[model samples]
Target: MSASLQKQNIVSNFRQISSNKLILAVSCYLVLILNYPFLAKTFSAIVNSADYNVLFLISVPVLFICVFNIIQSMIAIGGFLKPVLIAMVVISSIIAYATLNYGTVFDFAMVQNVVESDSAEAFSYVNLTAIVFILMFGVVPALFIALAKIKKQSILTACINRSKVIGLCIIIVGLIGFSYFANYASVGRNNRDLVHYITPFKLFDASYKYATRHFFSPPREFLELDSTPFLKSSNGNPRVTVVLLGETARAQNFSLNGYEKDTNRFTKDLEIVSFLNISSCGTATAVSVPCMFSRLSKSEYDKQIANSQQNALDVAHLAGVDVLWIDNNNGSCKGVCNRISHIEISPDSQSKYCDGEYCLDEILLTELDKKLKNITHKDTLIVMHMMGSHGPTYYRRYPTNKRIFEPDCPRSDIQNCTNEELVNSYDNTISYTDFVVSQVISRLLQLDESTGSQSTMLYVSDHGESLGEKGVYLHGLPYAFAPAEQTHVPLLFWQDPENSSFSLDCLQNQAQLIASHDNFFDTLLGVLSVQSKLYQKHNDLIAKCKGDSRIAFKQGYGIQTNEETK
Candidate 1:
């Protein structure tokens, strides 16, 4: 054959390969932008925002086009285009379903929940609508890619095409980087939520970080606090402190804290002091539960550091106080109860309130007499972890008979329900929580009367929940941007009048004070009559009320402590 004929053959092969690559890239782009509604909404918002100029509006789409092309080209070179594309589609679809249904942002903590969630929590997301949505948008496109035909190319042709694809991808990525650098300050300011909306990439990136941190990273060595003197109360009565560690119970819905609904009907009637303004350490159980019991404040609290150090429970146990942890929530006490005696209420445990899915908070009180009998110590500390108003299945948290709020949202997919209905369902859970808490207080009162023990109860929620507020649902947003609904939690206190030295009027006055999880560690230390170097008098709300207000309240991540008390 002549040189002209050979050149013509090469040109034909190049055209065919280029066409296939273009088709694959375009297919990926279309599937992603079309199926992932959140991504499209985010892009639209970015373009329409005041910060977006004509250049940015054009560059953003072109940049993503480049990204898809790079993906397509790389897969083509490896001859795995079909399988890779299908896998991407399926994963992206599942993520899209979660984002759309739950109004979740796929941030680092949210991805962590996905990784650490139990089978029950994971299955809670499965429903007919979500399944059908995934089938239609995710699987159908994947099937099309799986069934698509591709032509084999010569090795020489493949090499040439791959080189071109690489060069083009480099140019496009460079343009994106340069554009971002040009408007780095403004882009950085506005793009906080932008990364969250990016499909597939954000999900995988977050998952990778979580996996690396929790699994791949070296195990951190546990650290014990320095030995210090633990002075018990001089009073003749034995101290019995009950700490109710609540889950997802926001103060916004608690009637005792001035909510419109009577969610705290049972607790409001009692002579307990309810702190009007108390913020959580973190917006999730994994962070707040541990942080509340640690010496560190929210800003100073690192998960690894918090996990390594001995928490309040450990300190109490070392101080010769009998520590008992009763868990109704499925989560372990996050190492806070490791040294203490822990009783996890199994589903098999017979109770009027327990079902296979979730047990009523009241179920935690069942057989408590037997558990208390086991502790032989003179001074005892009991921590009950309650599953309080944990959503998006708030209705399942309480018994059917206790559904006082009318027209409650019955669906587990809370975003689909009306806001009023959602609030009703949530309020019902709160009411049930009130009843459970009242029962526990009554039990404590009885125990105190019968045994002549100096009984005290403290209730503090781990974090708050977001019920379709500004299209954000559930908890675990980064504390920096998290709304008050996710951080402002309820803190309640009850002390046996006969066995306590603190004045109830002074406690009530301190109830209106601005406080947070920073105060929890020292406050608990003060309540348990444990005098140690670890305890900060300034950080102790109870101690501060008793005329030790020398230390100023330092503002931290979740709560503003500088505000004057009402």
Candidate 2:
């Protein structure tokens, strides 16, 4: 009797263990909603953007899945994945919307990876793998059916569950200590050093010199305030010169010059001078932007740093002229804003966590009239550099309503999507940029009515983007091999309609004349009528305006004013 009783007890315990295993499996399966780590980051980012519609849409499915999964687990049920599949499809639309509305770093990552590998086929294969993964996701439901028959009595729990635990452990260890492979076994104390870990090819930057320079660079005090006004000169009184130093703007997609789309509709009315031959010195902001302001060029940037003096801003300030910088970029790239009074147009609002997708490009223009009127001195120079066409997430670069094309990263990986979709997302951004520039110029033209002064708005992008053309998307490759698409950019200057010097007839001639950034220093000095020892008329736009004295030095692949336009 005792032996029989023990046998019964053993059988009962085995049954209970199996029953419990079934319950836990069902419960954990519900947790599968949390399993796809990528979805959380993507959804969270959209919910926390400038607009709030997406956040609301995601809540419903999220609620349904949570409740249904929990109840199904308690009931020891299965077959709820159909609804989950539907949920992903719905969520993808919103994700697609978010992606289209802003710029992402995926393309940059792809290109940087390709360059590091020196492999065109690597990118192509990486793209192929993403498409295969997406297809695999669609068939995952059928594959899970075998789980219904598997014995759950073992310690492994489930293969997927074990994998998650292992992945988390690896992530923690990686974050805590820089592995041996890390170029520097040190993480930064402040401002998290994710860029070092990223940035293609594992090459490390010691100081985050590029990023920090935007926020923490020792200020060069490049420009200053002027105390006086200018009297009438040869062409009446001096006019306002608005120099727009575009941030991360690529010219290959700019419509006014040669893009296939109508990206420059807003600027259509003003004088349009198209220069297809312009280019930038470097890709990284610190290396190129500050260098552009400094006396340094591409080859001389790093080496000339200490010896360099008298930047473009300082020269403008010393000439007894009012110089103001209206910025919509990341905080003057870190104190690059010190000397000039700046307006922060980059979003400070984090109402939505993923607000980086869309830009507040309109923010800088709001103060245009007030800033212009506030300039107490004559020969005032205003520099506005917008956050233009910068992206890996091209879809996130503009607003949803601005979307002019379809099938864009309607899916996540660009390679997984179509080329037309990529171009469409990019073209939309260009359209918005065109409108912003045009609106700014239109407003400037209207100002002459009240101030009784002449003004000119000059817009030039810092650099260009690749947009999957030549297998590149973003800028900042090693300058040695940066394609023409990355280096060649757009340059435009519109004289005050009322100014006597203003004439549309001169635009074609003005644009055709090759001009390099080398002339930027002297050209700006001449335009503002600033008199200084720092200023040399040896080669200036004004001298060219007086006669044809401008000289565009064709330095290698870059354009020039003359010199054998070779």
Candidate 3:
């Protein structure tokens, strides 16, 4: 044969594989190569532990390979196999990237975060390194798989071959499971989160659940908590509560919460009560924002249910409070402001505060100033949703002047930067947040001083960030295994002393109490003095100190009950 003809024949032969062999190979690749992070984690958990033996460790990979092959055998058939494999390879690569780099799991909430995130926020995760990683592991393999030719067989033959392969895999898996049942059970019991780290399996499971819940589920019925909420202010002073809903401002990074750094420099000097032990409802904005706003507690918070029910803002609006939601974050209000008057601060806004990608949170202050001037209602609640310390482009969150910490990580690929540089960037965002919040309080204070408007500023973060702690670089981990850095958020409450009825000392004392997003719904109503059946005194953080606490129904009109509001 001629040289060119021989080369073509060799290449063609190399590209061909039996259908069953291809399925087995893909399964092995997924379990071993693509899931290197999962294997490494499993090794660390099993072999490194004193309880597991070498035999048990060896069986773990074997068990996974067998199980994965069984799964692959069922799916890898006809014309669908290559396409499915290609999709799996590509998605697994992205999941692996997140898992290996950020220590993130593809849980349902993380899937929600991905689905709900805007293009700007999503693209923030993309970089040269990530592109290269995906190309090497995902694109190349996918292209190869797509181009490969499977040795075709008759329907009966293909079915018999698949059945044999599956039977063999099941047998091997059964043998391994039976042999090391005790070891597997012990490890599973000890490291419950290990299952979440398994590549493709956890990712696929979460994606399926998310799709079913969002797309296939029945429409939820909307339930109004309070149809006739009323403000219980006796003195008739105009009430204005600027609830500065923060984003990713962790308590551990705040100076007011006893952080070593002076991140809260601006707000520290102000008469603000900082709740040191405040836990967030969720680790992601998609979950936390609505959960915090709804009357549902963290334990009972469901996104669908929360979205279907009336939130704190709705109750405030019903009570005749002028409600305004000013959003600076790309992730809107997560449906928390659906029933209220809201304005999103577009990145394309013709203002210096916006830089075409993300607006500095100072825009929230600017909007608040404008809103303060046009306040017509006696009771008003303005929610300023801030993009505070959101990563991996933490450097972009603050201005240059607010770069109080030196040598900050300025890029989105923060893993390349040193720990100090990364933290410096994160802390600067917090400092800038402090400055922005202080500015809001200042504007509110000015309004109070001039017109005697009863203004209270509540600065609470929707969630916290994970800054390279245990290799986790961002938030949105499954809440059960999430680190404190991802849940312990900062909450600061500041009310104008001249126009306030609640004592600052009392609030300051309550600041030391362990509070959470559960207190958020009722506390917001308490700030507006909204009286309704949904308002629970115990759930309200400041309800104890308010003047109406001594009255009938504890100044509001509800008993503190754990029953579902509907």
* Candidate 3 local lDDT, 1-566, one digit each (tens): 99999999899878789878877777788888878877887888897666878998888778888898888778866888998888878888988888888888998999998999999998999999899999999999999888778887899998998898889988998898898898888888888888898888897899899999999999999998778888885576687888888899889988887889998888776767888889999999999999998899999988999999899888888888899999999939989888889999899999998888899988887888888899898888888899988899999998888889989998888888999999999999999989988888888888888887777888899888888888887999899989999999988888766545566556777888988999998888887878999989998888778783232221222333223234
The lDDT values for all models are 0.76, 0.52, 0.85
Residue 16, candidate 2: alpha-carbon lDDT: 47
Local distance difference test, candidate 3 = 0.85
lDDT of 1 by residue, 268-379 (tens): 7667789989999888887888889998888898777888888888888888888889988874677678777898876556776777766788777774666566547788
Candidate 3 stretches with Cα past 4 Å from truth are 1-15, 48-50, 548-566
| Residue 200 shift from truth in candidate 2, angstroms | 8.6
C-alpha RMSD of candidate 2: 15.7
Cα shift from native, residue 427, model 2 (Å): 1.3
RMSD (CA, Å), each prediction: 7.0, 15.7, 6.3
Q: Give the better candidate number (1 or 3) by TM-score.
A: 3
Clashes of each: 0, 22, 0
Number of clashes in model 3? 0
What are the models' TM-scores? 0.88, 0.56, 0.93
lDDT of 2 by residue, 475-539 (tens): 66556556777778777766653453433444455566655565566666767765655556764
